[model samples]
Target: MRTVHEVSGLAGVSIRTLQYYDKIGLLRPAGYTDAGYRLYDDTDLERLQQILLFRELEFPLKEIRKIMESPDYDRDRALEQQIALLTLKKEHLENLIELARGIKETGGNTMDFSAFDTSRMEEYAAQAKASWGDTAAYKEFKEKAKDRTSEEERDLGAQMMRIFAEFGRIKDTDPASGEAQALAGKLQAFITEHYYKCTEDILSGLGRMYAAGGDFTENIDGAGGKGTAGFADKAIQIYCSRRGAAANCSMEE
Candidate 1:
């Protein structure tokens, strides 16, 4: 058994953090001394090690806790997975460093630029999970997408852009018109087929994102033409409203 102080020193985790983990039922001590000092045994230390590993992988504390407590939790398998992921991250960083060195040596202008072309969908998915860490929809999407090949995800993304381009071509149509509504239905079905369940509310949120003037807006415009994002957003709003769901795409008719 080890005191919290000893554990903190050996684990390189702060005593305060240990206390917080204990308070949250994330990492509890094995027992307490007669004098009331917390004592952690080997099993507790192993659990703490797992917690740190998950933390290093950028998993939220809640998600980490749920994963550790799940009946299917396998310590060795989890550690192996962590090692592989960290190895990939290390390799990615090394590649970036080498590219930087090459750019520095060559004055950067003659750079091949292919280093930036790496398929990083997994990295982006991790980031998205972190951003929407607690959302059920995000969790469902991640779960469903875990087995998808990078090439498959790329193809699906391309298909979605093509559909957006189709919307762009018909931008001048009335938002509630039959043509626009049919396209909106196709969009909803496409998302539901490839991603999460595209409820009306979710579709409306996506519509708002389409017109929010960032990467999504740029992609829509690039696909369908200028003003396509706004048109799609309005059409989506009309579609959702017609379905009697609350719509967040606030563009005027």
Candidate 2:
């Protein structure tokens, strides 16, 4: 685990900015020391890398959080878009460099200003953002959430956590057992009822996120007991596997 100071140094992000991120629920640390110092683990660092990439593409922090928190968020897809955007940025810079050289060589007589136009980059970014937000599941979630009050949202969140608390009670048993599988089904149904349709692919992605060692893990473990997130993830994996959806449920390190 790395301290906040170490992470700030390693990531070239100011400590104040990191603190602001934590405050805004953007990038939470893994844990805190006895003395109250924030500590980040490898998973946290990976999330930081994603945030940095999105920032490089000029995504607003609010948009970044929304995109990353989406159930359908795919790291590979985000990376591809980032690569494309960065390539465009690189090409734009090269054009500006060539333009500068031409102007210098022409003794400031060159009237070409096309190199300063960033419409292509701006349009591509808009399309990318639209694509991220255009998923059916995302649209459904927004529709469901649009009418919810703060109290209703909190109530739903607490109800879901209570399901994890149930998982905590049986976490020590075999995750593939009938009871565990039933609980996993219950959780899936709950998500579909309250949020978006929880397809096997989406559930598997959520399972990975639960044990990915960040706020989701911390919150689940807190609701249940220690290791509850991993237990639930295993149960979810087994549950999905039995239905021939295992191909989408493989856990990654």
Query: Number of the top candidate by TM-score?
Result: 2
Q: After superposition, how far is residue 13 of candidate 1 from its true place, in Å?
A: 28
Q: Estimate, for each residue in 1-253, the C-alpha lDDT of model 1 and write its tens digit.
A: 9999999999999999999999999999999999988899999999999899878867789988877876556677566456645554565677878889988988886556655643332443243233334566766777879999999999999999999888988898887889899999999998887787887867876776566454667878999999998899899989988876433333432
Model 2, span 1-253: residue lDDT tens: 9999999999999999999999999999999999998999999999999999999888999999988987768898787667767766887899999999999999999999999988657755765676578778778888999999999999999999999999999999999999999999999999999999987757766775576454667889999999999999899988877865455455431
Indicate the residue-level lDDT of 59 in model 2: 93
Alpha carbon lDDT of each predicted model: 0.78, 0.86
In candidate 2, how many Å is residue 32 off?
0.2
The C-alpha TM-scores of every prediction are 0.47, 0.54
Number of the top lDDT candidate: 2
Model 2 scores worst on lDDT over the 10 consecutive residues at 244-253
Positional deviation of 185 in candidate 1, in angstroms?
A: 0.9
